[model samples]
Target chain A: MVKQKSLRTLVAAATAALLLPASANAETVKIGVVMTFSGGAANFGKQIGQGMELFMQEHPEAFGGHTVELIKRDAKHPGGDVAKAAVRELITREKVDMLAGFVFSPNAIASAELVTQGKVPMVVMNAGTAWITKLSPYIARVSFTMWQSGHPMGTYAKETLGCETAAVGYTDYPPGKDSLNAFQTGFEAAGGKVVDAIPMGGPREVPDFTPFFQRVKDAAPDCLYVFVPSGNHAGAVTKTFADLGMRDAGIQLIGPGDITQDTELQGMGDDAVGLVTMHHYSADYDTPQNQAFVSAWKAAYGADSTPDFMAVAGWDGMAAIAHVVKTLDGEIDADAAMEALAGWTFESPRGPIMIDPETRDIVHDEHVHEVVKDGDRLKIKVIDSIAQVKDPCKALKIGKCGE
Target chain B: MADATRARERATAHVVTAHRWRWVEAAPWLVATGAFFLLPDYMTLGTQIVITVMFALSLDLILGFAGIITLGHAAYFGVGAYACGMLSAHLGWTEPVSALFAATLVAAFVGWLSGLVLMRYHGLTLLMLTLSVAILLQQLANTYSDFTGGFDGLTGIYFDPVFGVFEYDLWSHTHYWYALAWLAVVFVVARRIVYSPFGRSLVGIRENALRMHAVGAPVFRRQVAVYTVSAGIAGLSGALFAQANTFVTLDVLGFTRSGIIMIILILGGTGRLYGAFVGAIVYMVLEDELSKLTPEFWEFGVGLALVLVVLFARNGILGLLDRARSLLAERGR
Candidate 1:
């Protein structure tokens, strides 16, 4: 009877040992990454992934003794249902601590419900629509929003660039619409007249931008302030502007950060030279931190592979995660991480980046830059700056903003 | 003795048919109901699969049984989604029952109108005509950003509750059952439609429309009716999608969406009612699983498998099962 009792006790002890590992295995902080790593917007995800890798390699101690585990799932750019499915899988299946990465607003909106419902702290890496921040309480953005950079460009174009009458054109999509509307709001608010707002094709359609450019030329404004998102549109836009001879015609062309992205500069060459645009980060930032980041990036990915603002935003996302680990003593708590990120201010390569307490969006400097030839490579030269831009959507009189 | 012999033969034949068909028919639904309890953790993905199956079923009704090819079935889907989205978001129609009916009617109405033009063409012309309508609607949605919420998509929309009892949540526990019930209802109605004298006529038209016309079948009118009915089902699927996802983007109306559904239908083997469910389950689950397994996952394995299915199992996965059943029966005899 004593031997039987000992055998029963051994069985019970063995069962407990098997179950304890699962509960006690909380030493690793896992970030579920749902990004458009495939499909049309692959570049953004690729760059962002690289940026996170660079940060994780350099700052092992920031995790507060826990190993950072990243479980990535592809949202497929512009994928709606897939994004939701990914978030569900991440939260329930993999049991990830936090979530990050999205480039398009549509995908962000789709995943927002799961993020909100699960109470998972999702650090928005690049999706910049103003409405995205309002979706969930647990969401925090480490990237610049369309409203942040676009609204200030309106002011810059009118007050600094001295644009009296401007004709507007934008890529006909959600992000493009937000960027243009914010720019127009800021421009029109500052006593500058918008002659015509010409809409062009989206990613699905290959449209001739020449006609839209011709329409802008006919309007004959002081400058044509347009919103063109990155991808083939930016390349087509720079070529169209050059082909239409708008620069030679003495009508200046300007836009938001998407048009003058560092990646797009490769195709723009001389055409992009003197083309002014507004953005959160310039590759040519002269700060010591930025210099280190650039050097590290160059060392990791040759001299030709440069970093974009989206990549910097991804690095900042990891920085936010690091702060969460530091603040909570390496424990991954959703509520604590969200609370820490809501109004957290940290040193970024771009500068001192602060998340707005009210909106939970990145409140950082918006720089007005002109594309210039720096040696063999073309890069944006920061000419002017807008200090601490908050979300323009929160200040609106109406609209739910998807909340 | 002669009458008794004939009766005995009929009974034996009926039993064999029941064994092959009825049990086979109930298996998928029974397995799905059984899986509901087991797959609690994957309810969201499961719900999405159920919705896609419902969508594929609608396409099978037209493209598979009726022999009509369409590239823009998403038109009805978008219409239904927008109808639900606009009503719930803007007009304050919160009742799920009312919204579903409204979405169905709106989709059917649009389907009827487009059918008038679409039925006049054949082959590529018909395909292009169908595609054009969807594209036009998408462009209109883009142009009137104020109403449809433009490219930002119509946000701030959500379902009230299922029968004012169960509130839809992120876990999709209630949604799975709610959608399953709808699927069962639609499946029954579709089965009746496809098996009826009218369904036989539609199949006959698919085989040879000219011959069907000569046999006093009103080809165009019958085609229009079936298409409209199919559209209503697709709309219901779309309305459920809006309810499930709680948001509507222009995605429902895109050519890619239409193309994917078509691929699902073809992959599952067209003409069979059960094909849609199998196709959706296999496609969606594989897509969800494959995408997670690797970074380079692009449904390439799915594409390769589809090519193999078309080359080998001409009818679909169901066809392979049908062939196996017949072979087993032959051996048993």
Candidate 2:
């Protein structure tokens, strides 16, 4: 059995070696996508990759008279070394014009070195690390940082929703830590007091959230804030809170929108209803810009659709770059691309957003949403808007973009 | 008495033949050195291969020679990586050589303590124990994010120039040569240990623990010692990797890493130290390159190759090479 498996593996590998597509032609515009297609955060990169592919399909002439090709390279492991090598290979061997698609912040941080060394204009799609954009002159971000997404919720909770005392619960990891801190910083800045701040330490595959929710319930604050990741497991956080009967007690559930992720809230039934959260995108955030994107994406993928934050991120990224390419008329200029992208405003599915070239982060309207149980299904309803919120690093007294 | 004499005579003849071709043992190191000079452009890839080669070599000692089956050998690997990483980033221990050495000893001590409990079990329970220990270590590292960097990984950790003379450069050839030299040293030590009387007794224990213990082999103590040695080598490999990349993540101590290294050992053939060299090169290069083509389904290719190697080449690539060498000699004759 082992020997058979071995030969089959070798033959397949040999076939891949044979099918090595020739490197990027000098004439065409090549966008090297260095990302993790296989790992813990694979979906983050995959959605971005798909979004670009979809954009390329919609506008065949994306780069103004040039044949554009997206060469995707898996970072395999996000241990910095792999990302560096992948980016190097793309720049030197593939001769790609630009680079995009970084989901893991560590991978982005690592690839940042290569972007500086190789001098490739790298467009970051979705890595929320605060200092990622500060890596290189050639680097720019098309996605919101964790702080940008979470801080608005804190401000909204305090001033808009009239919540004075709140409880914050989050996983004990980097993104989780960053989200919790961003919320606390923004909440405290807005004159709100945190009654209880709890972190769920250890790994993600916890069988029970009963004990964690019990602690939050015990605090009995005006609002309960949670920070869980987005994906299949996101819905379970709300389901757990619902099962614990926290919502029935009238301590309104508010979280970093990942807990009620677009793709997941539908399957969560009524468990996530009235769950208020904030993120970069809410597909139900009715706008002419959103309608076109939601309709087009739904038309392609099917009607039962909710644009994942990752997918929206991917769509916005491609759209921003395409706008740059159109202005430049087939040439990829690093300075010009950065200049054009800086004040470049585009209608994203979320709403209108402009690229902040100084910080290289998106300046977008943060959607304050409510997960209303629409009959038998759950969907996000845009209840309020946080207008033109800049990157929340400015909220930090000493954070990356802060004074 | 006559049959025993005949068996002894065959063993003596076998030893003589192996000694006559002993220079072949230097083949991997010599080839790697040549590649280091010839393939300057591929130093990064070479560095990764050398690290993985060293990692699989350590596994070869325990599972191959000493017959200790483990599913979480990466626990030691992760320990060594984080130990070196934290030492470099937090404590300013920038000298790669001494930091790696100290980290190896730490990993060995951990292995010794764990071996005390693990040596009592034999099969699935033993597997579960090692796996749980690995998971525990990973969680502890993750939970204490302040120290471990918690998922963002241990970044900004770098090694000083070799002897403070050879500057760390763009191509990372310094890292490649350093790793390659350490690999040579580790391989030699492993060779010396495995060829000793203690190694033969380890094999005896593996074949039948009851008989070896009854014969006063101190089976449990021997197993623990070999486990510690193997763990030290794994830790060294991890330290080298951490130093070369200047970054370490929880993934280093992950379950998948343990599984991959085991497969590399098996695919190269067990009980053969040199097999690690052969298996890692084929596996790592195939993974690094082919993954560029089909990012999503490349593992399918890796899985298929492993299954084939196991089914047909039971002794692995080394065994296949041996058969080819003998076949070439026969054809020449």
Candidate 3:
């Protein structure tokens, strides 16, 4: 009987010893990534994923002593319903510590309530709608708003390009309206007048720009400012602009960088050359940090794939998340994570960036880039730089931003 | 005298059996109620599933029973969502029930007007027209960004307590129950309509519209009536969704939504009254679980399941059960 008791005691001691390691090291942080992984905008997810992965590999110390696990769910589309459902499941079922990767404004907006209710910090990677950060205190953005680029482009067009008047043609949606407002306000503030503003169909399909451009041509604005959601729309606009011979007609092609998105720029060929626009990041940025990032991206992905602004946003978003994780020491309280991100500054490939404490939006340099053809490839060359440009919509207390 | 009395008794017994509530019918509702206790963490998903079930049931009323093949039933759903959403956001109609009713009426009226053109055509032409209607509405919403929010989605929507009692909670407990109650009421009404003579005539029209017309059944009028009713029910479901989510996107009118409901009905076995309930539950659960298991490739699993169901269980899961039950009875005999 004594021998049997001794054996049982030994077994019990061994079981406790096995369980101690599991219980002692329990600082695992699960981040739920909700992004459109399928459909026309699927490249957004692929680029964002590449950026995040590169950041994680390069900056392992960003996570401190925590074991970080990524739980990715496909938003599928930008309708908001699918995104909301995915977010609800991630919070309620998976119980993720943080959330990130929203590529569309509507998807991010629909998830505001869920993140607020779940007490999880959400880092917006690519959704650039200005008021999204204000929707929930738990939300923070690394992506630049439309106003961030549009407003600066407007000022550049008037002061540098010597365009006295501009006409705006944008996809009829919230982001499009935001871009229109941004450019118009900046141009008018800089003593330039907006002659005409046309709402060109919706964003779901690429509408023919013949009639709209003809109307603008008739109005004869000194410069034409256009905004369409990036990808094929940018290619279409460039083709239409060239086809209509607007440049030869003395109306300069100028808008935000969305018109010459890096992914679609090569397809536009010579038509996109000499087009001047202001934006945050370009693949052709000649900074050492950007060079390293671009090389790393090429090494990681492929030589054929180009990292655009969306990719940079994703990389910076992960950097912010890592900072929060390190600061909180893996005991990631929702409020503390948000506190760590507010007013946080980091040197990104795009240049130095800071989260504005007042508005919870991104603040970075807006570079005026001129598309130039070099060796049969289109490249954006930085001509002028507007340093530390804040989101003018929030800074100026615009309509919805005020509330 | 004895023979006459026996025939009358037989007819009465048959009527009673037709109207009787089977124990099996109650099982699904019981399981749904049980989910409230068992799935506290899944209330949001529960609310979504219940709302989807209601929407699928509405589609079944037309496509399943009336045999009206529509590719844009989401048109009515979108109208309902926009009406309810705009009413609350703009017109200050905060009461959920009243707003739902108003939205239903608006959807039904739109359905009636469209039915004039839609009901006259059949096959691919009808399908194309329905798809166009949905696309046109989506564009209209997109064009009018000020009112519909235009792809950014409708915001600032607020709902008063349901029946001035139950408030929509963070856990979505109220949303689930509210949707369930509406589902129950709609289910009962739909059940009655399906078993009635009007419902039988719809089936007859589906089987052979020429024969139904030869019998003086007024095929076009019946199609229009049933389509309007289905649209109203679909609108109610959409209103419930808008109130529960407190937001609406152009997706409400997208082709994807219309296709999803049709797929649910097909998977659950169309023309079967309880098919919507089963199909919705299975599809929702599978989608939820598969997405969790494999986020990137979950659609492949769902597609595989659909192909299998179509190949083996041609009538759906219910049909498979029916065939099994008959085989067992034959063996017993």
For candidate 1, please provide the TM-score of chain A on its own.
0.90
Interface RMSD (one decimal) of model 3: 10.4
lDDT (tens digit, per residue) of candidate 2 on B209-326: 8899789889889999999999999999989888877778888888889999998888888898888988899998888766765776677878888888988898999999888999
Candidate 1 structure quality by residue, lDDT tens digits, A366-403? 88888888788787788888777777766763245534
Per-model C-alpha lDDT, please? 0.81, 0.79, 0.87
Weakest 10 consecutive residues of candidate 3 chain A by summed lDDT: A5-14
lDDT tens readout by residue for model 2, A1-403: 2233211111111122234442232135677888788766666666777677666656545444445567778887656668877787787667777898888888887777677777778888888877777768788887788888678788888998888989988877777888888888888889998888787764357546678788889888889888877544556777788888887786888887777767666776677778888876877777787777777787877787556777888888887777776677657877777888787888777778888857777788887788887777777888877788887775453454553
Given the true complex, what DockQ would model 1 score? 0.42
The parts of candidate 3 lying over 4 Å away from their true place are A1-26, B1-16, B330-333
- For every model in order, the fraction of real contacts preserved is 0.50, 0.41, 0.47
* Rank list by lDDT: 3, 1, 2
Q: Please list all clashing residue pairs in model 3, or write none if there are none.
A: none
Q: Highest lDDT, which number?
A: 3
